[model samples]
Target chain A: MSDAASVQAVRATVGDSEFDRDTAPTRRAPGVYDIDLSAGWTILGAVNGGYLLAVLGRALADALPHGDPFTISAHYLTASKPGPAVVRTDVVRTGRTLSTGQASLFQYDDEGHEVERIRVLASYGDLDTLPDDVRTAAEPPAFPPMEHCFGPEDGPAPAAGTSAIADRLMLKLDPSTLGWALGAPSGKGEMRSWFGLADGRDADPFSLLLAVDALPPTAFEIGLSGWVPTVELTVHVRCRPAPGPLRVSITTRNLAGGFLEEDAEVWDSADRLVAQSRQLARVRLG
Target chain B: MSDAASVQAVRATVGDSEFDRDTAPTRRAPGVYDIDLSAGWTILGAVNGGYLLAVLGRALADALPHGDPFTISAHYLTASKPGPAVVRTDVVRTGRTLSTGQASLFQYDDEGHEVERIRVLASYGDLDTLPDDVRTAAEPPAFPPMEHCFGPEDGPAPAAGTSAIADRLMLKLDPSTLGWALGAPSGKGEMRSWFGLADGRDADPFSLLLAVDALPPTAFEIGLSGWVPTVELTVHVRCRPAPGPLRVSITTRNLAGGFLEEDAEVWDSADRLVAQSRQLARVRLG
Candidate 1:
């Protein structure tokens, strides 16, 4: 079959979920993939960092011998937008337990020049092979049931053409944490929420990448405004998550020199800690 | 002068501190460096991951236009021994605010084939240019003064040929957190300490890299023993640190499938948050 026809066949086989469709990468060569940056996942006109990571994670998963991405660290050099982009992956090392690689997402600029948007280093492994040992010192934060939280559809509607990401995912924020959106900033530098796909797709290791960064900047609760660009983000996927909405808690502990570090922990429906991430981002206050 | 002579001249200019001497890289070319990994910094016969990061960070700081590394994420592919290694850096992007780059530390294996030991991606920037705004939601962990805590020299001397890292730096563990060493595990999954160079050198961005990972793995406090090899480590240097011992706290919140995540925070003498790090590592229990 022709390359285009093969991609079409793969797309037909994928689930109807928007995440599956948008993050699906068509292999162009051994380590190159062509991905379409879907417009449905954006914050302030720029593609969401986690969503972009999911796209890169998909490409890495396809290129590497391993089936799951265990750890991924991405550096966002430039903001990316919705369009066609190419992801080039390089397998750095293929170990017995883990395979390591790097991927860079490139998009065409206004001058028709290919510019690098995001660079990522990830290690892929078989999550099923991990030892079934569990120990927890941190408990999942206390959060109300999904219905009691402030969901994406709960607040005053965002102006048209803004916050496209809200339409793509089911994000139910803790009502108390949404005071920032209601003109009464919490000043607590924390936001807790329940997250899942709107299309009822099961959350997997790949989608957990998106869940880690899907929340609004915790800085927003402290009354900081404007764009908060992530400089670096690192996520460790602990295990395959249970099928349900994930519980997520993000907090900004220190904001110094306009740069804040946000730490996120994701728990599966079984109350298992599935993923943890920390990101350094700039709070571009106007 | 020839390259060898130039390297010697450069070495002569470095401070007498072991950290400064060992981490100082000699540029072999525009983006290539030759470094000698000092034997003084080792834990359980393997080179410390943070010390290795410092070496790579030095190479990157030399190649990049920026002065200090603000963010660095490194994947430990293989454990490296003290010896000569080559670091090759690639300037990914040199933005006005931050210059991003990648560096790989390679060493010749026993089979005479060069093997990669560590791969790093870092962004360098001028800390002076950062805004003076400081708003912290997380306070430094409380601990006894440095002299009151359990200093490295206070404990039973490590049997000869073990823990070379102990002689290289001053580490005072919070007495309450050292129950694991006394056969009574804290079960808290936390380790707090005061860290500084034994040579009295003040900690900087580069040295802070080592300081972040200098403490014993928090798993030891929870009774999980044996080697804990870090799979991936990421450090965010928040600002220039004041000259004094740094207060550091590292905690493991969750451990699943023999893999654990440790989050560390470093506060400088001024009580300013200077750096934060999170690493994913395996708890190799025999």
Candidate 2:
């Protein structure tokens, strides 16, 4: 792709409308964000964590004193919905070589009450080889492709009958990486599928994580009809590894009381752990 | 001990009056809770993720429906401080048995603009045992007892001393079972320790998380002067392990542009991953 087209693609990815947050609608009318459950930007059900992550990327760009590639490493804290939220950020200490910052999130109610919260630590630095001690837990989980696992009859057909966002990418998961438990008898129960985004897009770590995070937890866990708005999704990039068909493994760890939580971890096609994700969802029983 | 004496002792251990916060001249009409940058809360640093975790636990309880146990398992999303922050939560489905939710936190300006956002997922459930396929990656980190770690020389000694709260039925950690990575290089960076509380406190999962989250992050990571107000802290609990001494590790991942971010993880002393944490801070840097 030409440089212009690449730039355009990046723009197009972000240009898409943001999630229409029905619970915490963004209040721009008063030029102040009044976090009320009643109103907020609502991302359609199509919106996934990847989309929000992109939006967050843009927001971070705007927040940084000088726009720099701020790589998110870990998130320590956060809150639940149906309540008020709060966020915090701090600059550790900026040195000539490297700089770091942390941010936290919380949910609140209309009566000026806090509902839930999350915290994140981020660092920006001149890319260099990290200390050898910084290694991932293990290679990615082993699983078949989304097609082999979910099959076409499973759920929505891929956007062009293709596995990844772009056609060329493929996730070559080594089945022996981690022993994976099979899905429930329903065939729709939680399952992990190894995936890889074709080159080009994979270079963008956020995009890779977005795709990893965007995979629906319900698809692997619960067979739900229609969209189950992901109330919240968190992604932690343990270490950025060479991108390819990164292994994306997901499982619905626990589910009850109308709410469910799923666990996900991303590993490179080479089997190195790249990122980790979890989603708390409101499943609509099909 | 007499009943009256027991009550007095308990109060002394978990005493609120021990805090000189109310008397601080810089803090007046302290919006329900005004934490001054100087003389912050004790545990870790007067102001660190632990304090915010304490506050967030209270917020989750307050926001719950009828304040049910609201056992929340949250994932850290992002962190930023000293200004507008955002946290998003997904109200996973609500059901009779268990429920799950997700949240994100962001820091923004007064104009309702997002400064940083942290996204997290949470789960609520009744305490029940599933076929526990429990295994941890590392044992909890070991450290001197809290008394030794935070002893008189560590900082201002808790007025009531260790014996004060010792009698209370709060969770007690057996550091032996916890996984720990002691800070190295003469501790050139942050520090982490693992702990498990005795199963004495309220069994409400949220309450338990709140108490554990209340530990100060600054305490683990050494070398810093003056107080820093915790803009916020978030907590995420995965599967609750047997309440015993759990490993808690903290590291100053990065610092930049007058902002800093820290990463923390909690593990059962046995080394099973309990919960992971991150914090975004705005430091005085004086």
Candidate 3:
């Protein structure tokens, strides 16, 4: 089948999927998953870290005694490729409120050697059981209303990059953030955008794995370009997102010794803080 | 021997050791070591997250094919207790620039069952090999000179917090940030302190594990505080810290539905940014 035919068939049969079915896993045992990779997930010869984490997180969430991820941290040891690998999880603790576990992704080599790639520790708890809402400080970023925002229908494809991850996630970047991408670099290191799946699926804990890191590197907006690899990323789920457009913002307070910090917070249409993330990344000279 | 006799014997022989000497291992085996927990490191009968992480980090740093930890993240699953446990490390990838690995701390129950209590992912690289510094942004936090600042030597011990970990570490909080501890709560959720080992050891990658999370939970300085346990913590070692004092500050921007985020930055006496950390913790109303 041609590329167009495959795309049409996917649209007709499966209305929405963050990743291809080939990358899906088979759970032959407890806390273990046998997963096959798909080339479609690769951005530029390497699988997107956020996407990889979402899939890995799904495996852990499904295997754990509890289901929802309250806090998760993933370290990208290497670029996971399109091949066979296994995800393993170890139970750390199971409490009345929160359960903690460690998940790892492993790929077998030619001599039947298992090489670990990505590892994470996540705390799981029911979103419904959150302590009664009592917010004393901090407010969500102010974003333009939906009518004024720019979606894919209102603009051209992202011409500055050819990333598959970008194609899968539709972004309505704040006009102020777009100037830097067009070569009129903004010295400020920050990114603000409205985000949702391209196919229009409501996000769950898994998709949030990708959403938290969806914004372009804040450094790109600060005159530094090229690939800014994230050394470590940590996300905390404050609450399950309410359906509709998710507002996202990322800011860098310090760019020192060739490294920068990216701090992000995600809010739902209901104006509830859904997730918060922080990452440490090295800036490449472009 | 009387309690005083044993204390005198220990002071004469062991000098400064939080963990037991019997738990120390030879260099032949990387990542496999029997560890004994010390009650002295416990805060309210449970091991302090920062102190436990420091021990775990030492094992990983010593066992790694390379011996430097530039970035490390730890998730507290169970409150580690006084008992026997083991530290295990898995090589994720050994690269030219950065090497990554995962370390797990396991504690056994009375029935001989092993349970994972803490897990971390650490990236290692030689401090001397970092690219020539080109940080045009992010100046260090402005602070007063040492002579003008206060030290714990000039103040009273923390009130009624029977934590030996407290005795092991000394903190000199900024006067502006000390209102909360005295019952005159500072409505602000922030903490800034000058830190050094009570035993006088210069800060290193291991001590930094303790240093980054050493600040009192950001919630305490705010109006809420009974016990705010950290669910997850991440630290980035930007550069080798210079000799002398260390400045640490933690601030929480949002307090929503009983959860708050703490962002921390650490600067060495040389005014170089040595490390940065962030943690998510549940708020306890005092």
| Alpha-carbon lDDT, every model | 0.88, 0.40, 0.74
State the DockQ of every prediction.
0.72, 0.07, 0.47
- For model 2 the local lDDT of residue A146 reads 49
lDDT of 1 by residue, A1-286 (tens): 9997665454222256778889999999899999999989988788999999999999999888997988899999998989999999999999898999999999998899999999999988999998887888878899999889876577572422478888767888888888877878889989899998876787999889999998878988988877889999999999899887899999998998879998999999998999999999988755
Encode model 3's per-residue lDDT on A1-286: one tens digit a residue.
9997677455322224645354356796988999876655556667777777776777877777778888888877766787888999877778888888888888877799987778888888888776665545668787876566564446553433566566666688887776665677677887888988766667666667778787777887787767777777888888788877788898887676667778888888887778888887878754
lDDT per residue (tens digit) for residues B197-246 in model 2: 23222122332343444443342233343344333233445445454545
Runs in model 2 lying further than 4 Å from the true structure: A1-45, A62-129, A144-189, A198-200, A222-226, B1-4, B8-48, B56-171, B174-206, B211-286
RMSD of 2: 11.0
Candidate 2 predicts chain B with a TM-score of 0.50
For candidate 3 chain B, the 10 contiguous residues with the lowest summed lDDT are: B11-20
The better-scoring model by DockQ among 1 and 3 is 1
Colliding residue pairs in candidate 1: none
Error of 2 at A23 (Å): 24
TM-score of chain A of each: 0.92, 0.53, 0.87
